[model samples]
Target: MADENAEETYDNFEKQAADQAANLVEQLLAALPEPETRNKPDGGLNPVEAARRQPAPQPGFDGTIASFAVNHDVLVPGLYLSRQDGDIATYDLRLVKPNQGGYFSMAAGHSLEHLLATWLRSSAYGRQVVYVGPMGCRTGFYILLRGMKQAAAVSLIREALQAAAAYNGAVPGTASTAECGHVAEHDPAGARQLAETAAALLKDWTAADLVYPA
Candidate 1:
């Protein structure tokens, strides 16, 4: 009976997550800029030419971004080097499978972002840590570092996540309104849950695993 109830609950959760993901995708598509229009030789609207000549939405940027180019269908929960710009290396700390009906709630993602950022910024390799933040999709995080070797970066991520899983006391830097915009939205327990999950998935993870699955 207990197992049956648990299975039912899991099914409900999956349905809710799928529904929410679909809605978010809809909203994103709705917000995209319309393709620029062009006049045909006969003065009728020419959509094909318009789309081909549409200015890049972001200034000076051409072509699909690196993150979008990744084949999300095969991505799994693990650390990956998303890209590198000069000395900066951006690491994708994927905690959930992409579009798999599993995701971090906003509160959980918010809390984990704070915890991980605080810990990583003060770690031994802190000097090389450039930035730490969550992905918009709520599936993972991106950490940027400079002048750090792949092996060192791997160890750094493992240590930071382990610390987060074992963390106690107040979440760092969320003490007041000045420190955080949504102070009450944080869920430290949820953050710890996510950290533990990610840590387990990354157990025995090596620099070799940093490559995104082909």
Candidate 2:
């Protein structure tokens, strides 16, 4: 009974810490100055114009990315926060490790993109789903949502990936599709195999999966 009490105390302490972290972020964001609404008259900023005007966060890095801060050698699959603007949050839904020869094959990634994007945009949570697409590095996808919680983002991606894992329909963009241009390159079987592997990894996510390793 003492051990059970200890475990309950530990759980409550953990929840308090998580709540404190969330409150800190809320305070920090509230302290920032208002964004420059360069192109609007009603004090509203167009997201596209704001994105175009903001200075690159890491100009000297490759592609002006802050990714240099990450040690790709130890990178693992998980939903890492990429950027947040107001309520929109973009997450790196990484499924493969980089610089370790675990990158996705072209056929598999393409099919996975089609399947996951379709599922997310049409799912019950579609109202919060903004965009889903493959990354240039061929490692995984970028999923954008309309909220800022890491736990909720991870849950949504896991559900989407699970759907993709069990998908057996005619892969969109395949030759069988009436509007497909590169139909011969599609691989539904390869896509399902990779999604199953990715879904397994996501099932056992840790805090390390929510942030980039430095």
Candidate 3:
């Protein structure tokens, strides 16, 4: 009886996730500058190819811009160039699809952001780790690294992700009132799984994945 109840609960969770994903798909399709295609020209976009997507400057908002709205349909989970100025490069480190791939609960995204930011700031390439934060969309993160090119940036992120995947210790700085906002919402275990999933997707990082849909 207990097992049956647990199975039913799991089914409910899956249903909820599926329903949420479907709703998001509708929203993304409506917002995209380009229409969603049933098939990608090729199998699909590979690697950091998405790196070339730069947000066009908005009229106002103090020079703030939006990401390439057209390519939202093609954006996949991986490293992509967000923008660059001099030695500073911002990357869209997508973990979930814009609307359909996977969903990160708010608590999960928050914990992952905290842990990832902490890890990146302390890694061997820590000097280049400019910033690591979650996107408003909650599908992934925006990572800014200084003094690194695309390939180097990918390597740095891959290593950091591997670390996050293997992580088993307490999430640093997530429990202190003075240290974080909503610190009690941390979910280190969930965060680790997200990291592991992303790392697997990038294990064989290749040049093929470096080009966005043409």
Candidate achieving the largest lDDT: 1
TM-score of 3: 0.66
lDDT of 3 by residue, 1-214 (tens): 9999999999999999999999999998999775454576533444354444535556765653546542877777877777777999877778887779468878878878877888888877888888888888888898998887678778778888899889898888865788887878888888999899988988987635655444
Candidate 1 residue-wise lDDT, 131-187, digit = tens: 999899999999999999999888888889999999987988789989999998999
Clashing pairs in 2: 175-183
Q: Clashes in model 1: which pairs?
A: none
Candidate 3, residue 75: how far the Cα is off, in Å: 1.6
Provide TM-scores for the models. Answer: 0.71, 0.64, 0.66
Per-residue alpha-carbon lDDT of candidate 2 for residues 1-214, written as tens digits (9 for 90 to 100): 9999999999999999999999999999999999776766545656786677777776463564555556778888767887777999888878788877868888888889888888887877788888888888988888888963677677778887899899888886564647565666677888898889888888977435677766
| Candidate 3: C-alpha RMSD after superposition | 26.1
Q: Rank by lDDT, descending?
A: 1, 2, 3
Q: What lDDT is reached at residue 55 by model 2? A: 75
Q: Name the lDDT of candidate 2.
A: 0.79
